[model samples]
Target: MSRSDEEDDDEDFQAESNAEEVSAAYKLFTHGAAGPITLGHLRRVAKELREDVPDEVLKDMIIEANGGVKGQEKDVGGVSLEDFESVMKRAGLSFG
Candidate 1:
């Protein structure tokens, strides 16, 4: 039994969508982690995204996500889950 081309295309699209979701989660976590996530987590995710995003872009994202203050440190900086949701809504992203 073999699958059809349409099946393969559907599978590929689904896989790509899943990958995008993973990437989005990493981006969101890197930007909005309150405490459960750590520096190591951000470093790993940033390393993964390096192949796709430029270093300067990531720096800018970090700065923007951190409320315009650069390198405030996580202990003193973070977006609450409620606030994260609000920001996401403002940015046209939605959460279930």
Candidate 2:
């Protein structure tokens, strides 16, 4: 196969792997729920895991996960799966 074809195959594999990672992380945060993950949900999960993460830090995470857009930090309602995936990618974080 050509170099370009190999590159495409690699990209496809990477995409599938990323999707799986995001799905797992999202499920962990949402407890298998079918809605966007909220700050409360994150806090509860952290507490359950005994992570001791501060609320401020969690808020910042929510904002960042929401793309850190201008004028939206204060109104971040929740973190959708897509937003979570984007933030995880941007931060180089993985569930693996």
By TM-score, the best candidate is 2
| TM-score to native of every candidate shown | 0.37, 0.72
Q: Supply the global lDDT for candidate 1.
A: 0.52
TM-score, cand. 1 vs. native? 0.37
The lDDT per prediction is 0.52, 0.79
Local accuracy of candidate 1 as per-residue lDDT tens digits, 1-96: 357988877778876775566445645665644442333455566676775555455555544555654334534233334444445556765334
Model 2 agreement with the true structure over 15-90: per-residue lDDT tens digits: 7887897898798888899647888898998999889999889878877777663244565577888888777777
Off by over 4 Å in 1: 1-40, 49-52, 72-83, 94-96
User: Over 4 Å off in model 2, which ranges?
Assistant: 67-76, 93-96
Clashing pairs in 2: none
